[model samples]
Target: MTNAIEFIHVKKEYQEQDVIEDLNLSIRKGELFVLVGESGSGKTTTLKMINRLEKLTDGEIFVNGKDSQAVSDRKLRKDIGYVLQQIALFPTMTVAQNISVIPEMKKMPKSEIKKLTYELLSKVGLKPEDYWKRMPNELSGGEQQRIGILRAVIAQPSIILMDEPFSALDPLSRKQLQDLVLNIHEKFDTTIVFVTHDMNEALKLGDRIAIMSKGKVLQVATPEQIAQNPANDFVRDFFKASLVKNIYDVYIGRVGMVQGYITEKPNQKSMLVDSQETMRAVFKILSKYEYVAVQEGKEILGYLSRQQVISYLSEHEKD
Candidate 1:
């Protein structure tokens, strides 16, 4: 239950303009927390402050319960792993060399470093024999990213900072890397702070997501809560932008409010449908169940009774 990172009254100014103002947030240890927003929203800036990539003009940031300012950047970064969208591997280094950078820097025994490097490469589905000596350009985009992630995690840092790490890859590669990240978190129980502009990506990967705009956080909640009960108009529209454009032009999330569906605490036995599912899909589940739970990813948003769906359909049919 301890916080891995905390921002207190944080502020960052650039050219006399407030890039981040009065920010306060905390990320729990071993949790996969996400920061989501569009460009210039300060989500990226907020992430950088944790590792001191962007220095805060005012206030404090605590990493692992200690004042971040108290630690030298070199030492702090050594304990924290970082992954980036650009996959900034050393073009001159081999894959094994890149993955073993941290351990080597720490003066770990050469044999130990090689053992760990090969073990991690295999963990990510790369063959040690084939990839050990490959240069950055020898790998494909996705392969390069896999190596980038390996480099970050090779040292087994408890906290990892990911800045749009998968954003530059193709859709298939992105999904694969996302799954890899989820698997890594489960396997290591590491505290991860992931930043991305894609809402769908956030919902799929975040245990809790914080939405930001104009250097301010708009809402912070589970993906399900944000989907069903957005904190404001901006939040609502942000969630909406990720939904499928329904043929009826009625947003599924809006149907519960416009019609009548009992919002209840998530029940373990309820039939489930994603909030992004089409109306036809909801009807199929409703045909067999009295009520179906609406969810986004693994989080339950609310419930929609069969009656609620029928009533809305009949009303639309009449029109």
Candidate 2:
């Protein structure tokens, strides 16, 4: 499949100091690609280059196969959604108006914008009428973040870039939003480029994750692949610091996520759990019964068990 985005020998430097060193990557159409690294790893810098928020210091970026530089900044950005850590929803504006900012800029009809505002708010678990007149201050941080996400995708952009969008929220709220992003991705079939310092977030959300260090691409692989086999010592310890966190994120209602542990294959008789659900949600079922099948959409990846989960956690402890 033609990639939705491609980075070719990309580099960025300040005062002749390289921040992104010869980076190259490809993001497939409709797939969520995550960039994970410590601060100054250039993940955010890479995302900025896509929208021309930061001018590329070197190399080329192709969005939807066309050179990103070929498109003018204003027009290109109009087709791409962005959510920041702070989630800058205009404090003064009502929720509807906040969401309608870009659509209004695009000269969308008032009726259409109104329709879109309601649809988007509802999709993110808010009602239009209730929230239409509410200002940012009236909502909780989680609600505001949800609204910010709705605003980003109000235009239904083909690509969305998120920079640690949930890092500011409490763990429960963050998990909810992660589920929201997964839902949005399914609904829109969008190609997402998410940057995060959280390994658990990357594993939970990314179809593939690119791990970086000091401006270099250290490794790029699926969560299971990286967990089972890290690129090097840095990648190994990178996952280690958060090993318990990773297991929590991986196991919570999501046996399908860590499917490599399943010894028995799933079948029609197998108990079913949504791939998006977490281990915590289904612990009773797992403890009472021996296993439950983990599924995404219609496909069953495998069966999950509490024992296997406990065992996996023990093995990965690096004792």
Q: Which candidate achieves the best lDDT against the true structure?
A: 1
Tell me the whole-model lDDT of each prediction, alpha carbons only: 0.86, 0.84
Model 2 TM-score (2 dp): 0.79
Q: What is the C-alpha RMSD of each candidate to the true structure, in Å?
A: 8.8, 6.1
> TM-score per candidate, in order?
0.77, 0.79
Clashes of each: 0, 7
Error of 1 at 23 (Å): 0.5
Best by TM-score: 2
C-alpha displacement of 83 in model 1, angstroms? 0.6
* Model 2 pairs in collision: 252-278, 252-279, 253-277, 253-278, 253-279, 253-280, 254-279
C-alpha RMSD of candidate 2: 6.1
Off by over 4 Å in 2: 245-319
User: Model 2, residue 238: what's the lDDT?
Assistant: 88
Poorest lDDT segment (10 consecutive residues) of candidate 1: 242-251
Model 2, 58: alpha-carbon shift in Å? 1.3
